[model samples]
Target: GAGVSQSPSNKVTEKGKDVELRCDPISGHTALYWYRQSLGQGLEFLIYFQGNSAPDKSGLPSDRFSAERTGGSVSTLTIQRTQQEDSAVYLCASSREGGAHYEQYFGPGTRLTVT
Candidate 1:
């Protein structure tokens, strides 16, 4: 399918280990976003990338979490020193543009478990 997709649908890592999650957005989409959904919690924004503009990292929980979009297409989110608290579903979404008016297409997400 040409829709947004994430790799390693499920990831299990030991505490203190680093993990990387990947997301592939639909072609031609100029806006990409990363979010996290923890148990019983609402979706938490993580980052946003729009074309060649500087990515918005304000939503990232901490310095341990970082992301990048190469060639404005594929995106990767890296978590350094994984912790149990970081266990959650990492979601990726893409839109035609970086605006609230544009609808975003979401991927199935990558579930991360730190134990």
Candidate 2:
């Protein structure tokens, strides 16, 4: 009954701090995704989770960025040693299933600011 939702609509953090962003996908959706949008850039795929399979993390920028989806529902994206370059809108999306055929529903991204 709900759409994808991300937490702390806005986050302001220092350059070296760590932050954990949360997302709750629509119930029963078997596929979830994480993306980041930098100023003037297109959405960057960060990760993907489908059902109980191992997540696709090839899109993650670096070792500092990591994510996890627990019980095929809620997901958390953890950014370690945040950097100024990391300041961007973190978006979460979910679909009934994974692949090019399924439509993804997006959330009002969490805006992260590294000061």
The lowest-lDDT stretch of 10 consecutive residues in candidate 1 is 1-10
What are the per-residue Cα lDDT tens digits for candidate 1 across 1-115? 5899999899999999999999999999999999999988999999999999999999999999999999999999999999999999999999999998999999999999999
In model 2, what is the error at residue 33, expressed in angstroms?
A: 0.4
Query: In candidate 2, which residue pairs get closer than 3 Å at backbone N, Cα or C atoms, i.e. clash?
Result: none
Off by over 4 Å in 2: none
lDDT tens digits, residue span 11-110, model 2: 9999999999999999999999999999999999999999999999999999999999999999999999999999999999999999968999999999
- Global fold similarity of model 2 (TM-score): 0.98
Number of backbone-clashing residue pairs for each candidate, in the order shown? 0, 0
Give the TM-scores of the predictions, in the order they appear: 0.98, 0.98
